[model samples]
Target chain A: MRVLGVDPGLTRCGIGVVDGQPGRPISLVDVFVVRTPPTDDIGARLLGVERELERMLATHRPDAVAVERVFSQHNVRTVMGTAQAGAVAIVAAARHGIPVALHTPSEVKAAVTGSGRADKDQVGVMVTRLLRLDAMPKPADAADALALAICHLWRGAANARLSAAAAKVPVSRLPKGSAQKGWR
Target chain B: MRVLGVDPGLTRCGIGVVDGQPGRPISLVDVFVVRTPPTDDIGARLLGVERELERMLATHRPDAVAVERVFSQHNVRTVMGTAQAGAVAIVAAARHGIPVALHTPSEVKAAVTGSGRADKDQVGVMVTRLLRLDAMPKPADAADALALAICHLWRGAANARLSAAAAKVPVSRLPKGSAQKGWR
Candidate 1:
């Protein structure tokens, strides 16, 4: 399964794509970041995001998309930022007909670092280790996105197995190419 | 002078255009609403907003654009909504090279109702009376947007007068049309 994970923001967004099978190690297929100038018009900024996402979708063709769910707090300005970023990511996935799964920050952290309360640095360290990377993912947002993808991979596998077991039928009874469905 | 006002939203956006100068009563040149289905792709939704705004701009050839300024708040989801809406409006204005001005809700309310704390119903009633219309404007968003435009005109005129007064320096030392040049 190939999963595209996105960390959305108005000024900067990070995208990561990973490919792997359900019980096997996931491999990073590609990773990149997009940045928009603060002075640019809002339309131009959104266009930049759309163009980059379109290119990533075309090139990687990930089967599913995972995005960080935004939760607003007291700061109206921060809330606006989170909302714009979330909207952009959601729109990008929706545009491609990709089923999107939104994960909370804690869920992502727990999946990647084995602790829901893990800090950014902890999550980054664990993600690098789990992915067997040469170093920690640069720019915390990219690492967070990758961790989100890894979380999906792990959860997806668990869900698939549970689904197969609950069906009270052999796993082979499922669709023949179902394993390939999640990956583009 | 003509002013176009936009109220941006995820599923539906409202638009209104008015023509007139400050102090003198403004006329409702046009008022309409545009909508995008939730199921539509983000790009398509944006395109819809763009197309509608462009059509209005072309048909009316407004001299200025007025948009609602998003207020920062603690609610992430609400902020996101406002930001997305704001982005669409900003993009539309920028695309046509129109001079865009953002007005706060309170400012618009005060301009239309003579009280910054006016509620929507009060504002609507005041708008009707101010425009000498027979009935309240339809579609609350559109009415609010129109009020925003009216607010801009009122403020713009006051600003113009202030600039003119400030420019009454030694006439010989002043550049011709300097005040007008700055306004433009």
Candidate 2:
């Protein structure tokens, strides 16, 4: 599956595209940052980000989009901008009927580096190793975005497998006291 | 000037359109709320709000758009939704080349009810009277939207007048302590 991961921010939104499935090596399709002028009107800045993301969505045509779920940051203004940028990414994916998933910073870190509390350097190193890249993706945002895409690939693939396995099981063969009766 | 005012929210986004200029009677063009199902995906919800806003912008063809500036509310989730909705409205206006202005809640209240601390009821009553409507706009959001529109009309007109007056002033007539020297 192809997944486009976004580290949404008004100043420099990181974009990373990865192709992978569960238990497989992920390949980097594309990586870049979408930046808008800081001096521009807030509306214009958002529009700029949205336009770039829309173009990426059309260009990459990923199966799913993963966005960093913005949490409360030190500065309210900064957090607001982050949240708005993330919202734009989500809407862009929804417009194209592509599924969108949000991963928290910790989740992405844990998924990529096996440590939820991993620092930027660790995450970047792990991403570089996993993608077999000669050099790590520069800028923390870029590495974080790749982590998000990788996280979604593993998590979503696992969930899909679980669902499929459950579907294949016969209801009559279910053990007693199972919650399967609720399915009726 | 024609203005579209939005009181942004996820559950119910209030929209109000008005037409008026400085020192003129403001006329209400339309007022309504755009709602999205709460159970819907966040991306779909934002898209729904954006669609309604775009339609309104096209139909009304407003010269300017006024949106409420969201601040931190009691609920962080609610505030995030409000901010996202507001961002969508701003983007819609920007796409159409319409100038967008943000008015704080207190500013809206003060512009309509002569008191920044006025309650919803006071603002509602003032909006009803100002628009010469028999009934107050239902739901606090609707009234707040109209107040935003009215606030924009008056404040923008005043600012324009100030700019025009400043332009009309000759350099020779400027005071020695005036900041116009820096402006030049």
TM-score of chain B of each: 0.83, 0.88
User: What is each predicted model's overall lDDT from 0 to 1?
Assistant: 0.74, 0.85
Model 2 accuracy (lDDT, Cα): 0.85
Which digits, one per residue and each the tens of the lDDT, describe model 2 over residues A115-136? 8999999999999999999999
Q: Top model by DockQ, which number?
A: 2
Q: Which DockQ-derived CAPRI band holds candidate 2?
A: acceptable
lDDT of 1 by residue, B50-165 (tens): 56877998899888888777765534444455566666566556556777777788989999888999999998888788777889987788788789888988988887787778
Query: Residue B160 in model 2: shift from native, Å?
Result: 2.0
TM-score of 2: 0.88
lDDT of 1 by residue, A1-184 (tens): 8998888765777888888787678788888778877666555665677678779989999888887776665455555555565556665666577777777789899988889999999998987887889998889888988888888888777877877775787667877755331100
Error of 2 at B96 (Å): 1.3
List ranges where model 2 is wrong by over 4 Å.
A161-184, B164-184
Given candidate 2, what's the lDDT at residue A182?
A: 9
